[model samples]
Target: MSVSNEPTLKPERPFFSSGPTAKFPGWSLDKLKTESLGRSHRSKIGKARLKYAIDLSRELLGVPDDYLVGILPASDTGALECAMWTMLGPQPATVAAWESFGNVWIQDAVKQLKLKNLTALDADYGEIPDLASIPQDNDVVFTWNGTTSGARIPNTDWLESGRSGVTINDATSAIFAQEMDWPKLDATTYSWQKVMGSEAQHGMLILSPKAIERIESYDPDWPLPKLFRLKKGGKINQGIFEGATINTPSLLATEDYIAALEWAKSIGGRQAMFERANENARILEAWIEATPWISNMVSDPAKRTNTGVCMVFGGDWYESLSDEDKAGVPKKIVSMLEERGVGYDFNGYRDAPPSLRIWCGGTVDAEDVKRLLPWIEWAFEEVKASHAN
Candidate 1:
């Protein structure tokens, strides 16, 4: 892909797109360039920085003292898979699937892991499955926020407090954008790209004391790959959850993660990040209310996501247009915005309804969202004008 020489069409406010969302406020490529490069990850200096990054994350997120945070391979997907394959089994499990990612976990549990006594509770993209009836004795897996569908569980109080089963939460897009009740969760996973505004290779896995206990005691009769091994003969591997990663991580990416953390801290930490996301979402909410054709995918106001704000067109806007023209609307709108260099990746997930998924995470400011909304309207108009016969 060749770089464009055309002058950038700066947005009046800012731009938003769901994942690999906007860069951290005031982030610069030069900052990444200046970071120490070509350092051995296991060396004392590298380890110290890596440990600092983990400690900083714990402090910023208000993670419990007993929980262990580890940097894993790939992104949130890898982190979730690691948790599923490692800790699940030897007991009946229940999966709550309301979105693409949660469904992926359901498939993994029933088909890949071959867990026979599993129950899958699901709903369409917009709402959560009824949690009131799930057995309290079975392990539960759910995504705290549905990045693809823009629906999120507003609270963790749904889980029975004294239940023996565990709760594994995929909180990739939820961590910084919303308040997470750490005490209510057992194993939580997130990615740097979603809320941290970093590269997508690193996954953060935090295991609570209860989660560690499960790993230490449960001896499931499943073969374990090196990547999925968290315990050895009922003994939890404490070192892996520390600075020691399963495989070598990109030192540069690690440095970038640290830089992103520093940037988060500089902006008044998690509360400030939450405020930024809420403010951006409010801007979009106002836009959605006034716009006749568009509305949020998540119907419930409280369940709506602050990050990954997805909007679907109303009524027969699609039926009115010819198939060829209708098929091209989303692509045309996305391309127009991209050509203007105002936003990227506003297109919805392939599996989702024909909608636009905008990023309202902390990395993006409200001003950017305000600017991008007008361009979105302009793009729709331009596309309609060109496509109209």
Candidate 2:
């Protein structure tokens, strides 16, 4: 019997989803086939590769020498939970929530941990709550970039330099894509799927000297989960900060992380990556200005994110359309682009206001973004055409 011939499925152009964003420019399936399979993470070879990856992260991000870098289980959520459960109880806490992820942390602190004396300062998606209102006496938690909202904190200037409280930063979408003032931060967490474009399930946890000191000197009275425990008797277990991950990790994932780091370095490191993201943002900014119905979700240009540039339909763009038309607009636009093979996941987050989120990260080429702009126009035209029918 003869089998019928058929073509396998493939994406023509890349998807520009906010995260689990884009892979390295030249990535291919063959790279994975050559990776070591069934290798123990504890093996000397595996440890070396892991160590090298951590070291490269430090060098590329310009993390201080005294800081500790470790690969954590899960993604940014795991890293943030570990810090909150382990290190937050020693002092009063203030959490600033401007977007979905920031609100998640606030929920963890208030509901999950049930910490009293916690102040939750929140703002709408496009704006930050007053930074001046944050208490200097309490440990502060905030995102450097609000990926879902497209708003970002301009810098660490709002933070008090000599404050006794530690600043924990959830920089999942900000790292490598924007400038981070590490000196003002105590503990910072990021995921592999963001700027680096590696697979998810891995997080990078960086602890400053002050953060390490807090872990070593301050004992939170809360019961610590094994996964969240980072210290004993006010001292960070050095092993956990080194190769001692709380749970077993995928060696294959670790190798991919290493490769991503190497790719980041070869592309002129952090500055180059920043430039790439910023350039992408500029391209979108130009288009947004020209488009009548579209506008950025972020109110302040100073705080607009280069990585995740979210846009909302202007005025009554939604209200003006019929209910069916409105409901189908975002879906149709995303589907049309995906079908055309020009862009993939550009849909705004469900929790966010109806909008489109384009990921303009380092791994995404500017030329691809330029190509994507025309497709976005075409997508809206298709949507309009459908509405007219």
Candidate 3:
């Protein structure tokens, strides 16, 4: 492999990990000045700050008035457990496990909760199960986008409009980056650390009226953990949906989320955010089309996710290597990128095939992605030259 010239351009900000993604374009510690620190979250000003976050999120994301949006103690996982424990026992379950995150939900539904009636729909990395097979008669749980594999459901057309069952969506990496069909979703969960590029340690749970009605009317036989409780005295905890969180939240994170929401609103809200994300992805797509040595991990364009843009090494020379050596290529490429401070945490998820998983969320500028492309080729050539047999 002939090495290319060393690249001089680099992304202005190299914080591209999917979780704890890049913050708004000009974020700094000064942005936390408005944070309500040293005060109880139960205090008047504290609750107001929390409410501000929820209100801004609802407004910026175009959440309907009929739905309830709230902050939860755990990151996306905690909010998911709250939904499963509160709403799943009475309904027969159908889970779609396409990638690591979806598989986690399936494991929770089958092993952790020990549900008696379960139907699992599965697919390998970079693919999705047959979503049409999901029955409306039973609860269906799935991730909108497989963060690790970079696969996503193309749309919500498979969901029946007036179904009896509930739809639980883990949209941690999808929200903000993609347009959500709220009418098709009963329960949606995400963390601040994802698309919004805020700090973690908290989750956001959005429940449709039907989801609230389901949990308020029915109770699961299993004892709910303190973290998973959504009902009290045979009624839904309305306070939780109104900024009264289940546990204490990080004030700094709350303020940071609010700042991100403000930034989203400044840039024309959700629509603008979606366009920016898509534009960043387009930059990568153009690069992938031109580059012969790499290809998208997702073969199907429709199911591909824009944010977690995953790619694999290709070409005859690479394929001739043993599986072990093929796996080592991504590590070397990632190490080269990080060593040069051109990108960080660009390695694929552990459970997925070895590849580069670059974050292309709205917070990331398209120009930066353009700057990063040449460096990827430079890193690949450096690694290939060193590994020449």
Candidate 4:
């Protein structure tokens, strides 16, 4: 525990990247079903496997009976783009962003889509956007959880129950770990690489009847890409929701997602995953509270996320360092931790303020988090000592 010495105890499972996060507990490649691997995606077995994966998602996430849940190419970003490009132009649009991924949505709305009547609501890092201020009857776009900032919307109660506009939410980091008001959400997107801890490249998109109506009724003046085309002959393509993907998909990744979903079901479904993530986050947040030199970047418990908990230097000595030196402290601590084999990829997002982001998603073991804390404290102490001298 000395400042100059590394912690003897290290986390056994410390692969904590925010996305493509640690896999489900007891996960192994050999556990995946191989029957669907080499078959044509359109064939009977391939379609059956894909449909089964979608069915599992619908059941575990508690999607509405009428909602269409399907897999999309290009991970969460592409899925969000599919929703935004197809459904946004019919009404006045509004986009809210507080972190990196959310900002990408804003840019797409303003710079890419070129929506004439658009309202962009933004908040500083470590803060949540004001959802209460969203204009009524405007197609709203936002992320349920700000992955980079470690801030998340506390609830969806602010969304008008009877609003006319479609609400497109990037729930890439919020899916299984958060309780979403499914009825109020129109077009919601998440990634397998996130909460499910599955392979990357594929994203899940959920669409309500309202969102479907938007796609079926409105056509943007801009030319639609083949992948973004949700409508065929001015009617919603029901096939896509039924395991018909726009492009070829990785069957291996599909099996991996199916395995993760099965594991979730085995462990008491979404509630258990939520609890696991909450407990993991609580461990790290509690450490921040007890440790004098560091603090949660989000500051407020209500606004903070249960995944990707961001940390900031809060000690008096850290405050006294030059801005340049202060910026390097987190990197130094992260590098130290990596070198010690206690953690990896815990550094903050490139665009985010110099900080560390520890993934505490459902897949991350709570015991690993508890063991990782002392090592983090040790790293911070060593970094602070180096800066002090």
- 109-160 per-residue lDDT for model 4 (tens digits): 8898999999999998899877888877988999999999999998877788
Error of 3 at 50 (Å): 0.5
lDDT of 3 by residue, 171-260 (tens): 999999998999889999999999999989899999999999998898788888888888888888888888899899988889888888
Evaluation by lDDT, superior candidate among 1 and 4: 4
Error of 4 at 90 (Å): 1.7
> Which regions in candidate 1 have their CA more than 4 angstroms from the true location?
1-9, 12-15, 33-36, 322-327
What's the TM-score of each model vs. the native?
Answer: 0.94, 0.93, 0.98, 0.97
Per-residue accuracy of model 1 over 1-389 as CA lDDT, tens digit each: 22223324456434466777677866776777433467777877767777877889998999989899988887899888888887788668999988899999999998898887899999998898888777777888999999899999977667878778888899999998888888778889999888988878889899989889888887667887787778756687776666777788887777777888888899899999999889989989999999987889989998899999888875465568875666567777788778777878888888887788888898887777777777777777666556453
TM-score of 2: 0.93
In Å, residue 240's CA in model 1 sits off its true spot by 1.8
Return the clash pairs for model 1, or none: 13-368, 13-371, 14-368
> On TM-score, who's better, 1 or 4?
4
lDDT of 1: 0.82
| Tens-digit lDDT string for candidate 2 (1-389) | 11222223333446688889898888765565334467666776666666777888899999988999988888999998888877787789999989999999999999888887899989998998998888788999898899899999987778988788899999999999987787888899999888888888988899998888888776667777777778755568776666767787777777777777878889899999999999989998999989887889987899899999998875454668865666567778788668757678889888888788999999888877877776666667666656556
